[model samples]
Target: MTSSQVFLSIALPFAIIPLVLFTSSKKIMGEFKIKTWVKWLAWIATVILVALNIYLILQTVGILK
Candidate 1:
């Protein structure tokens, strides 16, 4: 259970972070680039997810209890 949690928290963010970054990049996405508001929202969501993942890892390590 713990191993699964670690794997999911770590892997999920890696996948999502890149998606947000790439989509927000004008050079990479060209005419398909995301709007400023959407980019900000995506970044905010990404940061929250990452922070939650970090908290989860700390909890799993007995550092947050």
Candidate 2:
């Protein structure tokens, strides 16, 4: 259960890091590139998700309480 918890919280969300990068890259998306504001929002959301995942991992490992 602990491994499952860690995998779910950490491994799964790691994909978003690349997703945002690829989507925001003008060279990658060209005309479909994400707008600047939306790119900023995505980065902000990615940061928040990473922070929350770190918190989750810490709590699961009994380091946060």
Candidate 3:
């Protein structure tokens, strides 16, 4: 991917984090709180996504050389 693509990939997840946090609230879930396992999975997924984005950035910048 190009620099713009790498940037967008990183930006999209950064943007989604706020949306996810917003949806996890009592306002969205009402009486249904987010489960521990689900939260853990989300955290893990976020970490992996971030790592991928960082790797993509490094690759695009030729830092992986």
What lDDT would candidate 2 get against the real structure?
Answer: 0.88
Which candidate ranks first by lDDT, i.e. highest?
Answer: 1
Question: For residues 1-65, what per-residue lDDT tens digits would candidate 2 score against the true structure?
Answer: 46887897888566998999999999999999999999999999989989999998988888997
Model 1 vs. true fold: TM:
0.87
Model 3: residues with Cα > 4 Å off, grouped in runs: none
Give the clash count for model 3.
0
lDDT, model 3, position 16: 62
The numbered model that scores best in TM-score is: 2
Superior by lDDT: candidate 2 or candidate 3: 2
| Count of clashes, each model | 0, 0, 0
Model 3: per-residue Cα lDDT over 1-64, one tens digit each: 6668976976978776775576567777777857767777877887788788888788888899
TM-score of each: 0.87, 0.88, 0.71
The order of the candidates by lDDT, greatest first, is 1, 2, 3
Ranking by TM-score: 2, 1, 3
Model 1 lDDT, full chain set: 0.91
Query: Whole-model Cα lDDT per candidate?
Result: 0.91, 0.88, 0.76
